[model samples]
Target: MMLHTALNWRYATKRMNGRRVPDATLERILDAAHLAPSSYGLQPYSIVVVDTPELRERCQPAMYHQPQVVEGSHLLVFATWESIGNAEVDQLMALIAEERGVEPASLESYRHTIAETVARLSTPEARHQWAARQAYLAMGMVLTAAAMERVDATPMEGFDPAALDEVLGLPERGLRSAVVVTLGYRDLETDWLAGLKKVRWPRDRVIVRAE
Candidate 1:
């Protein structure tokens, strides 16, 4: 019920106070995102933490000059790998073996399964789309974690991706921005949304249970 309350209290904060989120609290939120599940447990996304004002200032134009982009304490850019093939599968298998204390050879069949899925994509675009979906799973975790921590978070997809990619040097890193979220404390005095009620589709209309 604590999570329920947190979700109810949180909103897509439009204005921020520029108060920095504590490092420990930020880490806990990031840790939750890291632990989010992905296909075959092969997480294909990376989070770029942008906490410096200068950097956020540079990112402002890319985000269409959203005030929160600069006023927020930090930005979390979730990016998907530009490629995911056999090599990525191999790395996942190796990490799994190391973490579970098993032989890499024992994971051969599982590795093949992951590789086969990647091979089935047939095109770079398809692979990128698949990876982007994985990135959004992590995004959900990030929003929930921020809510639980009582940190204002605003997930955004209003940016020019190509411009943002260039600004952040994402192509060189083999990543492309999938989504961005800004974190900070909401400004109660001036934010119009602060006093409004949270609106959503009623549960009965949104949820459908089928036999």
Candidate 2:
């Protein structure tokens, strides 16, 4: 019920009042993104939290003049890895081993699964598309987390990925911008959609009953 209320209270906020989301709240929201599930436990994405005024200014034009890019306290650029390779999988496995206090080789099954992912996503196009889907999952988690924290967030896809990568210097890190989520407080009076009802298809229509 609380989640429902939170979801109902939220929207793709069109205008933010440029108020900063509290640091603690921002941490929780980001943790939710980190904890979001990903394919093959790779979690092959990076979130660039843009809090600097200069960077936000640079980002606005990249987002095609979207006000949220500049108005929000923080802009999360969900960029996924250009490609997942054996080296990447090995890094993740090593981290997992360190966290669990076990040898990386002990997780053979998991390694195999990730190896399969590397093989399947051999092509650049395949890897980019797969990485983007994982990036979307991260964004969805951030949206729900922000709603629960009573912070405003706007998930945006209408942006020049190439331009964003350039602005953020992501290409050098072997990442490409997949999507963005701007975090801030909504402008109560100015946001036109703030007063509108949340519209969606009926639950019965969307939810299939297999049984």
Candidate 3:
């Protein structure tokens, strides 16, 4: 019920008051996203934290002059790898082994199975599409976390990915910008949507029982 209230409290804030998010609150929100589940536990996306005013200035044009891009306290750019290569898979394998206190070789069979299946889509276009989807999962986690923190966040997709990539120097890292979210406090006095009620489909219409 508390979660539901939080969800209701959240809205796509169109304007922010340019207040910085407290470090502790920001950390908890980020931790919630880090704990989000990803495909094969690979966690292929990297969240780029942008808080500098100068950096946000550069990002403004890339985001098509969205006020939130410059007004928000922080901008989170969720960038995903272009593709999952052997080196990438190996890194995850090593981490998993260390985290689970097991030999890396123990995960060899599972690793190969994933590679053989996903390697077919190793092409740039295919991987971008696949990686972008996983990024959305993290986005969902971010939204929920933001709500829990009583912070305002706007899930944004209105931007040029190629332009943002160039600005962020993502191509050098073999990463491409997928999605973004802005975090801050909404302008209560000026925001028109502040007093409106949230509307959604009823549960019976959206939730179907397979049985």
Q: Quick one: best TM-score, which candidate?
A: 1
Q: List, residue by residue over 20-122, the lDDT tens digit for candidate 2.
A: 9999999999999999999877888899899987999998888999888778899998988886898888888899999999987799899988898688887
Runs in model 2 deviating more than 4 A are none
Give the least accurate 10-residue stretch of model 2, judged by summed lDDT: 116-125
Ranking by TM-score: 1, 2, 3
Runs in model 3 deviating more than 4 A are: none
Candidate 1: the clashing residue pairs are none
Q: How many backbone clashes does candidate 3 have?
A: 0
Angstrom error at residue 24, model 2 = 1.5
Residues 175-202 of candidate 3 have per-residue lDDT tens digits of 8898999999998877787778877899
Best by lDDT: 1
In order, candidate lDDTs are 0.91, 0.90, 0.88
Q: Model 1, 1-211: lDDT tens per residue?
A: 9999999999999999888999999999999989999999888878989999999999999999999998898999998888788888988888889999999999989988888998998886887789889888888888999999999999999999999999999999999898999999999987899999999999989998898
TM-scores of the models, in the given order?
A: 0.97, 0.95, 0.95
Q: Over the full model, what C-alpha lDDT does candidate 1 score relative to the true structure?
A: 0.91
Residue-level error in angstroms, candidate 1, position 105:
1.8
